[model samples]
Target: MRLMPRSLFGRLLAVATLATLAALLLASVAIGHVLERFVMRGFDDRLDAQTMVLARAVDARGRFDTTRAIDLPGFDEAGSGWIWQVRSADGQVWRNGAEALPVPASRADAPPPPPPGMASERARDRDRSHPGEGRDRTGQRQHFRTLTLMRVGGPVAITASGPRRVVEAPLREAMLPLLGSLALLGIGLAAATLVQLRIGLRPLRTLQAALGNVIAGRQHHVPTDLPVELAPLAHELNTLIDQNAEGLAHARRHVANLAHGLKTPLAGLGLELADRDPDGRLAAMLADIDRRVSHHLRRARAAMPGAPGRGAIPLAPAIGDLVDVLRRVHADRPIAVDVAVDGVTVGVDAQDLDEMLGNLLDNAWRYAATAIGIAAVVDAGKAVITIDDDGPGLDANQRAEALVPGRRLDEAGPGHGFGLPITQELAELNGGGLVLGSSPTLGGLRATLTLPL
Candidate 1:
């Protein structure tokens, strides 16, 4: 039902065909008009000549007769292709071979009529008044011409007619040649238009290849070798990628700087406190400083590299390492640390995986009275890691509070509790997140990290 073609090639060809057809049709009409006019003019001239000769044959006495006909070369009675009517001095009229005869009438010329008595000059003047005279009323009529001439002061008039067949017959005969030429011309135009469309779209083909190379990882930037129109687009795309790289580099630099600025001061405070005293305010302050230092240091050490992440870290080894470290740290009691991993990996930095599991393990150790557990595996297209403790689980409010940084279950309350905060921050930086829930393994609080691979 759609008139327009879907493809550019079809549309272009259709447009070309329409244009050529219209031009060919118009040329046919114009050429037909010109040839028809030319032939009709020649026929009118001949008709006018006959009318003049007959008009002159009538003297001032109004005496003329066309029955025996006037003699002239190429104007024979048998096949002259001319017809005539003569109204003589006796008012007797005679008609000839044509189906219809034209009436003779003189029109008033704006410039002025020809000299009153000159037959040569006056004939052309007389013919102009009857331009449509000999044409037939039938729809399929052939072309014809007529000329009428009147004598100065007599009742005699001569009218002549001819089957413009001499002109029209040749015109009809010319149809095939003209049509053939137009067809050839249309074919040539179509060929030229096709070449033009291909040439015009050549640059687009080059651009497509360039984009393919980039997508295939064969190139980092769009190709610079392009026509003028495409040059600006390529330049803009290259600039955008460069700017994005610059922004990532800057953010990484800032994160590193923030971590460095805080760590140096904490180390100085730790050394100073260890030198002071035991069983005093210095001891409590030392503990707080250690917790603060560990919290910030954990975050700083866990920060991933500045470069774009490429490979995923397998969750199994990463979680096992965290559980191993926790068992050592909480070795004073009969703390049991367990790990379950099913070979699933998450797309993240290695240190980021370590940091997320490390935080959950540390939190479990600090809160557990009997047992601590860790488990990680991939599920539903993502990596899920959970840590549990046997200590009394947090209520709704404490569970909510525990997820926040430095919010703890200890009577002293968790301050400088970087475990949950670092875990959540590292998860987010690696395009993942941390969730807080109740534990089934340790019957206490559970910390879960889920990351996309």
Candidate 2:
């Protein structure tokens, strides 16, 4: 239902095509009119010559001379659709062929003559039928283009006429080539418009590609070395990017400073509580407060904009290092760690990727009974990393609640319950996601991490 295109390129092309078609149509009309007039003028010239020849047969006394008249082809032939007439001042009429040529009643009533030595006054009779004289073989009224001349020395008028087809046929023949040439010119113009659009819009396409690189963290800013029209836009975009980066860095520094300042006081309180309380309840509350503060600060930092020009980090090395560390951390348990990762890479910072994977691996290490499986694959431009533990896994509701900060299913575990939440936040901040499910291979928990590749 839409009549116009939405994209800039599409809209430009559409406008160009419509404009080209309109111009071609106007040219066709204007050129056709000019060609028609040219043909008609040539036809009238022939009629003028015939009228002058027939006028020569009349003398100064306004008397017709039949023997002196020349017999032109299609002029004296009957039903030829070409005819001539001469009217004398004495009201005598003379004509060629059996057709009665229509003439004005008097010399004064006739069309005015042309300039001296030029063609005569011309008129077109389009619809009048002269009985059997001017009718075609099918009895249809024949049309004619007539030229009338008034001799200078006599009150005599000579008129010459030919069928309308005499002018139309040649015009039609000339138009075939004209129309064909115009059609070819139209096609050429259309192709040129398309080429012009593509060349003119190349800068826009380049700007789009540059913007994409900036968004993908491959470039720090849009390049300003563009066409004059787009250069200012690119400069403004780079300025905006720099401003945002500075603001994010300032906010992150403020959050980190505040968290560090809180940590010192929390540590002092922990020492004070350790001496005053034996049950350790106060110390535990202080520790929980410190953990919450640390969690929020970490989450805030993760949620901030990532640095530009961060290339893709290889998945295999990151996963391998995390798995090795986990194996050592859980050395007491006879856990078997199996890693099946590919050469796929993820568009996440190396430190962020390590943090997210380390958290997931540590959680799996704590809960895994005998074996842990870590695997990764590339799917739909994303790297999917799944960590499975062969331990008791949470049900549907527990799995959902486990993602919430400080929500631990088992109190026996030695965790502040911030690991899964931190991992999920980091994953999302890196344009990826983390989902918990029942492990199909290990029959326990499955932590699937999806990151851009």
Candidate 3:
């Protein structure tokens, strides 16, 4: 049920064409009316002049003078289709051209109204066809232009008339070129409309192409040399792209610093554990070695860049896989991981999503007493994934402290307290963030991760 076109160009072209055609149609009607009036005015003027000629020939004695009245060349012909008539209270007389046509009976009595008013009345003419042609002797009907007047001494009706073809033929001839000119004008208007539309919309089209280039990774920023109307938009887009790039570069540098800072400790641990010592101090050192390595590895994973074409990870399967692994890991605890994720997909790299979800689920398994719940949905063009656990959740103060990079609230717990910070960093890298709150349903901590769609 779409009546109008969808594209801007199509809609604009259609509207412009319709408007132009409508204007042309209206103008044609007005011009045709004016032309008809002009042709008729000229015809009536000629008839009036001839009528005055016939009137002037009559003297003060009211005598019809054939010698003087017949001086006009058309009057001398027998069937030229031009004819005249005169009428008064004393008498009425008329003359025909070479056609030898009779005067219309109504003309003498009433003069058939004034000139042009009687123009539609058909006059008779001889048929040019042979007897075998099956044509009428009176020939085709033709209209005339008749004029009537009254003299001082007597009522004089003088009509100089001709066939309709004589009047219309000239009008038709003139119209051929007029119509041709109007057609050219219409075509010119159409071309101008298209050119105006293209020039007016060129900046918007260029902006669209530039955006496509950025999305396709062909360009890092939109071009800035645009019209004043579009310049701000391009500048803002470039600024956004530069900001994202800077943030990504900063994250990469932080990860590199983490790796470099931990290198010496890792090397020393490797040497101590290489002796294969069986003492309690050696076991504690081994535990510390595992914690440090796992924390730094999670940080590095979280810092990885989210590039284009690095496929989005479906929230349901990713959370489900992590939940299944954690369930097995904590079999003795009897933790119930309930997943309620539908068709939500997060715009994050698959490996990054896995590392973030793995750390979060593992943290929940260590803390949760029995039941854990996971759910996801799409809202406002973003993916919202929430995980809830039924356990002794941390307070506001503890929650804030736990998000710090290396803050451990529960040192006795089987984690290095890097899960929330790593997950937060990973979410941000994917144009999203993480939130910690109280779960109303599970009466425990609720971890909400919001990522771009």
Worst 10 residues of 3 by lDDT: 125-134
Arranged by lDDT, best first: 2, 3, 1
Tens digit per residue, CA lDDT, model 2, 5-114: 98877898788888878887898889889987897677666666666677678765667898888767677687777777777756788878667764433454345434
The deviation in Å at residue 3 for candidate 3 is 3.3
Please list the residue runs of candidate 2 whose C-alpha ends up more than 4 Å from where it truly belongs after superposition: 89-91, 102-155, 281-285, 288-376, 385-425, 431-449
lDDT, residue 180, candidate 2 = 92
Query: Order the candidates by TM-score, highest first — what do you get?
Result: 2, 1, 3
Q: What TM-score does candidate 1 reach?
A: 0.49
Task: Tell me the number of clashing residue pairs for each predicted model.
Answer: 0, 0, 7
List per-prediction Cα lDDT, in the order shown.
0.66, 0.76, 0.71
State how far residue 351 of model 1 sits from its true place (Å). 7.6
Q: Please, what are the lDDT tens digits per residue for candidate 1 over residues 1-453?
A: 999999777798788789888988999999989888887877777766666666666665665655446645344564454556666535777655543453322332112334656777666755443444333434233333333444555345566655555776788888779888888988889889889889877777877777677644457687767778888988887788678657865775575576567667767776777767665687677667555545544444444445354476777777767767766866776686666776777777665666667667776777789777767766766677777888877777876776677665575735476677777877776656788878886689888788877
lDDT pick, better of 1 and 3: 3
Query: How many clashing residue pairs, candidate 1?
Result: 0
Best model number under TM-score: 2
Q: How much does candidate 3 score in TM-score?
A: 0.48
Which pairs of residues clash in candidate 2, taking residues 3 or more apart in a chain or in different chains? none
